[model samples]
Target: MLRGFTPPYTPDGRSSLVPAPPWHYAGTVLSMACPTEPAAAARFLPQGFGRATGRIIAHVCEWQATTDGWELLDPVNAQYREFILLVEAERDGAAVNFCPMIWVDQDISLIRGWLQGWPKKLGQVWMTRSYGLDHPAAAPLRAGTRMGASLAVKDRRLAEAAVTLDGGEGQSLGFLAGPTYGLVGAPSIIGEPTAGALRLVLPGITGRVAGPMASGTAELRFFDAPRDELAALRPTGPAVAAIGNVAITVTGATDMGVVAG
Candidate 1:
């Protein structure tokens, strides 16, 4: 039987409610700066935070990992896709990514994300790569190699994009490092017969970019989902789209405070 601080195990013993184990990711990422409706975006911002300096950015990527915690060889946690809608926001005069929506297919990921206030949900995600047999292994981001991904819920597709990393400049991951804010609603400890309290969670993780694609063109399709926060991503002009491999570690989280009513 599972004991200690490990999350409860399933009756079938197939899965558990534990966070993802430390892992490495090798994949391609596409980022674009898009136009955002200030009013609509503000709805996702937490208290004491304001809009960021630049336009909102959208990130779509597909990743294959050694493992997400149960075990290194576990197939269930080895691969997944991610779609992130990030807006620039300021907290205490510090810039950060105000992640409004993030979708993944794994359950453990969902739990861990919620614990950190990532607003993560389960969704169908996919990415594809085009390569030839003679392609040089040393240069994974070869010219003419194309990649694309889509984020969908049920039968509805919310976002889709395809890009070819023909050429681009090198970029540092430092530009991407900043505070990430998430909002989570949990049962009130006071036990009052009222709506559960919402808390803003900030998780701390260490990661770095491994590869870089300086420039690329992306064909994107975004739909409106009135009930979903992803609808806030409105790309006005295409920003520099790049490709890269990243490694990240999920350390822990910090609870900021309960949202004032």
Candidate 2:
């Protein structure tokens, strides 16, 4: 006998809420390329993907982003750094970047990145800004600029990189522009740890190469890393490097597939 009681529901009883606006980020990206063994690189890849060659793309970047949806309001949340170890691989007959390790300086970024299938973890990352000075000798003492980033966990330095930005190079960005995929571990129905592949999709991304190409060296200390997964990137030599600025919208993400336990 229900009388004079109305449920708080619409005619269709469907929720009508709009998704949050995309975040905007502006920053500098310093990149380097290294060669690694095919077998060694394969370990970091998932099913349906194959190593393109033996080249690994490593980069360190510093970014300033808007705090639209971040949980923390601290200044650290507005700015952060990232160190990525990427391997070139083929997926569905096309080349793509397979990210194995990604380190960030903030917890909110780490959590959001993990949900997108990025192998993100908390680490101390730093890089130098562009600077130059005139010298009495040494070719006008014009050192393009020196920048470096290191990943440390609990006072242990896992990786380090040093790069010098000298001048520009006539290289195409299309070759480097592609989709990225990562393996994300999650709890299964039985409460056992399971892993899956997540494909990150960025839409309306627009930007250009802002600075001249760069040359750098990278060193990885597997013994120091927490999981030592980055050891597979045995960087034998340098490939190509560049500096650029970008503005893009993080549309969303999709679960590509599940990894076998």
Candidate 3:
């Protein structure tokens, strides 16, 4: 019998790419909310889901995660960055945010996200870090402080953003605080007539605002990459941005229902 939870399972379950969760994470996020062409955004959602609102979100964050232990001694394996693009969607009149694309820097994080239906891929994600200091380099929680982040994959840049903090917290970006759904399953590989799929809602998401949270003016851009479809969801109007620190945890997925195979 396989001893590990995932592939490359070792007898001791020590070689699995990702460990079992109830994962915990502390992170700083740069979130951008902008209007997108509803029709274009609708194309990314799975069958039975529809565009509920006109806003889309692009978020970049740097995370330190722990599963079984603090992992502070193994910092390299515990830290990673992520970039996500999500659109507002609905099914059976219940609103949910659906992620169309997401990128992560670590293989472990990537695999972990896929297990929760994030459609995460390997990419280079970078962001500005803040510190509680008066140095010119330290971006403190003050009006006019600028921060930036970018995402790239296969050597091609997909999205970039910069924000200048103004003021405010909590309700600065309320739209970002919503339930998210993902379609998880495999397609028929051997030409079978039908396969199975599930509409999974990421579960056990309990977290709170951690540090400085501020509203900001933002500039976001999307580039046309040969493979990345980010250009399709580019913002069509002014964007609202914010910077926040949050500590979050996820247990896995709860069965929302089944969708077309």
Query: Among these predicted structures, which one has the highest TM-score?
Result: 3
Task: Give lDDT: candidate 2, residue 19.
Answer: 21
Better of 1 and 2 by lDDT: 1
Model 1 poorest ten-residue lDDT run = 168-177
TM-score of every candidate relative to the true structure: 0.79, 0.72, 0.91
Clashes of each: 6, 0, 0
- Greater TM-score among 2 and 3 belongs to 3
Q: In candidate 3, residue 50 scores what lDDT?
A: 66
Candidate 2 error regions (>4 Å): 1-21, 67-74, 131-144, 170-176, 188-226
Pairwise TM-score winner, candidates 1 and 3: 3
Worst 10 residues of 3 by lDDT: 167-176
Error of 1 at 235 (Å): 1.6
Candidate 2 lDDT, 239-260, residue by residue in tens: 4556555445554465665654
Say which candidate scores most in lDDT: 3
TM-score of predicted model 3?
0.91
TM-score, cand. 1: 0.79
> How far out, in Å, is residue 136 in model 2?
12
